[model samples]
Target: MSPDLSLIFVLGLRMAVAAAFVVSASIIAERSGPVIGALVATLPISAGPSYVFLALDHDAAFIAEGALASLPVNAATLFLALTYVLLAQRHGLLLSLVSALAVWFLLAAGLRALDLSLVGGLIANVVAFAICVPLMQRYGHVKMPLITRRWYDIPFRASLVAVLVAAVVTLSGRVGPAITGILALFPVVFTSLMLILHPRIGGPATAAVIANGGWGLMGFGVAIAVLHVAALRFGSAVGLSLALATCVGWNLALWWNGRRKVAVAK
Candidate 1:
C-alpha cells in the first residue's frame, strides 16, 4: 500500500472500529433498563476509544494533562444530563436536547476563560454534583417501555460517534490540553439516548436514564481525577487501567447493591 493510502485506510479503520464499540455499548444500555443502563452509559464508550488513539500519539504527561482537564468537563456533562432529565419531563425532544447541549457548551466555553487548576476543576465538579445528586434521586427513575427498533438506528448512531471521535482525534493537537480534555468527554451516549428513546418511549422514560446516570457520572469524575494522579506517578498505561477500574468497580458495586435490595424485597 502507498503511504497516503495506508494513512487513509488506518483512519477509516479507526472510525469504523470506534463507531462499532460505541454502538454496541449503547445497545446494551438501552436493553439494560434505567439503573444498569445508566451504568453502561456512564462507561467510557467514546472517550475510552479516543483515549487509546490519543495515547498512541501522545506521551504519558500529555495524557495526564488531558485527564486533568477532563475533570470539570465530566461535571458539565452531569449538568447536561440533569438539564435534559428535567426538561424532557415536560418538553419535546428538541427543547430537551437543545437545552442540555446549551448547558454543556456554556460550561465548556467558560473553562476557556478561567485559569482552572486541578483543584479548581475538582471543586467545580464537587459543587455542581452536590446540588444535583439529591434531585437525581427524586426524579431519575421511571418505568421504561419497550422500544421498537429501527433498521437505521444503529447505523445512524454509529456514524455520529465516529464523526465525533474523528473530530476529537484530528483537533486534539491544535487545541490545548484543557480543550482537548473537555472534547474527549463529550456526551455522545446521552445524545444518542435522547435521539433514539425520546420519540419511542417518551420524554419521562428517557429522562429517567439520564437522571439515573448521575451516580455513574460522579464516579467518572473520580476516575479521571485518579487518572491524572496515576499517569503522573505510574505512567499512562497504568493510569488508564486504574481509572477504568475505578469506574467499573463503582458501577459494579451499585449493580450488586441494586440486586441485593431486590432479593430482599422478594
Candidate 2:
C-alpha cells in the first residue's frame, strides 16, 4: 500500500475498532437499567482505545506521565456529571450540557494547573468524590424508563467515538503526552448519552443515569492512579493492562454487590 493509502487504512481500522467497542457499550446502556447503563458508560471505551494507540507510539515513561495528567482530569469528569445532573433538573438540553461542559473545562483547567504529583491526583479524586458522592446518592436511583430507540442513536454514538479515537490516535504525537491524556478522557460517550437521553426521557431521568455514572468514574480514577505507578515500574503495556483491570475489577465488584442486594431483597 502507498503511504496515503496506509494512513487511510489505519485511520479506518481505528475508527472501526473504536466504533464497534463503543456501540456495543451503548447498546447495553440503552437496553439495561440505569445502574447498568452507568457501569457501561464508565468503561474505557473511549480512553482505553486512545491509550492503546498512544502506547504504541510512546514509551512507558510517557504513559506514566500521561496518567499523572489524566488523574485530576479523571476527577474532573465527576464534576461534569454532577453539574449536568443539577442543571438538567430545571434546564433544557443545550443549557444544561453547555453549562456542564463549561464547568468541566473550568475545573479541569484548575486541577491541571495544580502541577499534580501522584498524591495530589489522589487528593483531587478524593475531594471530588467526597463532595459529589453523597449528593449523587440522592439523585442516582431514578428508574430507567423504557423508550423507543431512535434510528440515529447507533450512528450518532458510533460517529462520536470514531471521531474521538481518530483524534487521539492522529494527534498523540503532535500534542505530547499531557495533552494526549487530557484528550483521551474527553467524555465523548457521556456527550452521546446526553444528546440521546436528555431529549427522550427528559432531564431528571437522564440525570439519574449521569449521577450513577459517578461511581464508575471513581473507578476510572483508580485506574489512572494504577497506570501512573505501574507504567513507571513496569512498562506501558503492563501498566495499561493493570489499569484497565483495575477499572474492570472495580465495576465488577459494584455489579456483584448490586446483584447480591437484589437477590437478598427478593
Candidate 3:
C-alpha cells in the first residue's frame, strides 16, 4: 500500500483543528463546574467520526473496523478521565484503582477472545484513568469547591446524545472526515457554551487542566485515525507505530504535567 500524501495531510489538519476545539471546550466546561465538565468529557464525541472512517475503509469486523477506524483510544481516554472524576466524588483511591483494573482486565480478556491484540490499548487507557482518580481524590481534599454534587442527569443526557449521534453518524456512510469533524467538535462546542453561560464557576486551574487534558485526548484520537489510514495505506507495523506514538505522546504529556505540579508544590 502506497502512502496517500494528500489524505495524510488532510487528516493531520483535521485532527489539529478538532484537538484545538476540544481543549477550548473542556476549559470552559471545567470552569463551569465538575459535574458539567465530567458530563461533557464522557460523551464519546470522537466515536462517530471514527466509525465513519472505518466504513470508508470497508472493514467488515465491527470491533476491528471500529477500533482501527475510529478514535476508540481517544474516546476511552476521556471516558476514563470522567470516570476518575466520578470515582473521586464517591470513592477512595484504592477502591477506584481496584475497580479500574478489574474493568480493564475483564475487557481485555473479552476482547482477546475475539482475537483483538489491541488489549494493550485498553490497558493503557485503564492506567490513564487510574492515574487521575488518585489525583482528583487528593485535589478534592484541598480544593473542596471543585467537588460539586454529582448531577446524575448530566451523564444520562450526555450518554444519550453520544449514543444517538454515534448511531446516526455511523449509519450515514462515507462521510468520514465530516462525521469525525462534527463528533470531535461537539464537546468543544458544548463545553465552550457552558463556560460562557456560567462564568462564575469551577476556577482557572481546573478549567486549564480539563481543557488541556481534552486537547491531549483529541490529539490522541486523531493520531489513532492517522494510524488507521497508515495501516490501510502501508501495513500493520506502520499503523502500530502511529498508535504507539499517540500513546507515548499522551502519556508523556501526562507525566510532564504531573512533574510540573510536583515541582510547583515543592
Candidate 4:
C-alpha cells in the first residue's frame, strides 16, 4: 500500500482511538481502585501499540522485526511504570516522559548499529513505552478477588488458546489470510473474556486452562499474524475486526455477569 494522505489519516485515527481507550481505562481504574486499574491498564498499554503496527503494516517480516524490536522497550516501560505507580500513588507523568525518551534513544542506537530502518521502529518504541507507563501503574498488576486462584493463570491460559488456534488453523490447510484473520480473533476474545471473567480455577484446573489460555491467546494472535503476512496475505483487517468483536463481547458478558451476581446476592 502506498503511503498516502488517506492512509496517514487512518493511522492517525487508529492512534487516537488507542490513546482514548488507554486513557479511559486508566481513569476508570484509578477511580474503581488502584491495583485493579493497573492490571486492567496493561492490556491496552502493552497491546495497543503493537495493534497499531499490525494495522499499519501487513508485512510479516516487518511485523516480526517491529515486535521484536519493541519488546525490550515495552518491558522496560511496564516495569518502570509499575514502579512509578507504586511509589507515586498517582500517575507519574514526568517520569514517564523521561523514561520514554531514554528508551527511544537506546532503541535508536541499537537500530542504527543493526542497519534497520528507524522510522517505524522509533515511532513504535516511543508510543508503546509512553502509553505503557500509566497503564502499568493503573492496571498492570493482577489481583483477582473473585478468581484469586486463577489470577496468576491468565497469561498462560491466553497463550495456550492462541497456540491451539494457530495449530488447528495450520493443520486444516486453511491457513490463508482469511483463516489467519479468524485465528487472530481467538486471542482478542480470550483476553477479553479473562479480563471480564477474572474467574477462579482452583487445583489443576488453574494450571491446565487458566494459565495456558492467556498465553495461548496472545501467542496465537501474534503467530498467525506473522505467518499469514509471511505468506503475502493481508489478514490484518479481519483480525482487527475480530479483536473489536472480542472486546465488545467481553464487556457485554461482564456487564451481564455483574448484574446477575448482584441479583443473586440480593
Across residues 1-266, which tens digit of lDDT does each residue of candidate 4 receive? 56797665664555454444544553354344323332343343325433444545445444343333433333233333333333333324344334434554454345434532334434444454455443432333333333322443434433444344334333323433332322222223223322333233222221122221222223223333333333334454554444444544444454466568889999
**Model 1, C-alpha of 115: deviation from truth (Å):** 3.0
How accurate locally, in lDDT, is each candidate? 0.87, 0.88, 0.44, 0.38
| Decoy 4 TM-score against native | 0.37
- lDDT by residue (tens digit), candidate 2, 157-191: 89998998888888888888887878888998888
Residue range with the least summed lDDT across 10 consecutive positions in model 1: 108-117
TM-score of each: 0.96, 0.96, 0.37, 0.37
Using lDDT as the measure, name the better of candidate 1 and candidate 2: 2
lDDT tens readout by residue for model 3, 1-266: 34788655655554444444345445444454543443344333344333334444443333234454234334443543444345434555545434544453344334333432344444454565555544444333222144342454344334434443444344435544433432332333333323332233333334333433544555555555655566666654555466556655655665577568889999
Task: Please name the candidate that would achieve the greatest lDDT relative to the true structure.
Answer: 2
- Candidate 2 worst ten-residue window by lDDT: 133-142
Model 2 alpha-carbon drift over 4 Å, by segment: none
How many clashing residue pairs are found in candidate 4?
28
lDDT tens per residue, model 1, 171-260: 878996767787889899999999999999999999888898888988888889998999899988999999999999988988899899
Q: Candidate 3 overall Cα lDDT vs. reference?
A: 0.44
**Residue pairs with backbone atoms closer than 3 Å in model 1 (clashes):** none
